[model samples]
Target: MSLANIFDTAASAMSANTVRLNTTASNLANAESAASSIDETYRARHPVFAAVRQQVEALSFDTLDAGQTETQGVQVLGIVESDAPLQQRYEPDHPLANEEGYVFYPNVNAVEEMTNMISSSKAYQMNVEVMNSAKTMMQRLLTLGQ
Candidate 1:
């Protein structure tokens, strides 16, 4: 509703996008990693964001009190691992292969991860733009007063 709220929302989005990009990078880096067992395999990770609400309403002269207020920012609840099945490679000649001639690969999808990284990076940049625009507008308002 206010300029401050827009800034807050953009900042929170940028933070969440940062986490997304970091996790995507990690997943892409381990996409080709080979593991002897499923336990050692890497799983794709993602962050969960939750909306925060105002607990108490502030008293004001003109503005009426709203019982529930939705904040413009979000908080990361936690990171979750992908539960998809692991990749099974038939590498009988490979030394790391198990007795059954099977090697376990990580569940990371390199292409998907790369795409996610790009999207997150763009989202972060967009948020930066939002912040810059807000700052410029505020500066222009100061000039109006002068």
Candidate 2:
């Protein structure tokens, strides 16, 4: 890989982390949400990430010499809802309760979501630091001739 590609890699990682954080926030926001039925209840959402790779070719005397591999970065495959069972509570007096006196709550766990948020934030910060370090290195390289 090249020094310039570091920025792209870090940027992609930051974007992926942003998606993760957004999904975690969404899950947390709906953690306490109630629904009349299990099907209607909001489920915790998670982002899936995939790595992208690029093939690089080296040339010698205008002829292809060898191949090299480069990582482009991470991509969000998709957001998936958790399959865990929803919370079922019996509340006959609740207005949204079903005919059977039951209410469904999302399967989101606050502690898990909070941990995900923290990890995502930390990963994003690390990516930012990487980008800044790359910039500093590039600047230093520019001063080498002086």
Point to the candidate with the largest TM-score: 2
lDDT of 1 by residue, 1-146 (tens): 55656787898898899888888888888888898788888888888878865543534457775544345677889899998899999999987798899999988888788888889899999999999999898889889967
Clashes of each: 0, 0
> lDDT of candidate 1?
0.83
RMSD to the hidden true structure, all candidates: 3.1, 2.9
Every candidate's lDDT: 0.83, 0.90
Write down the TM-score of every candidate.
0.85, 0.89
> What is the Cα root-mean-square deviation between model 2 and the actual structure?
2.9
Q: How would you encode candidate 2's per-residue C-alpha lDDT over 1-146 as one tens digit per residue?
A: 77778998999999999999999989988888889987788999999999988766544456666646465999999999888998999998988899999999999989999999999999999999999999999999999999
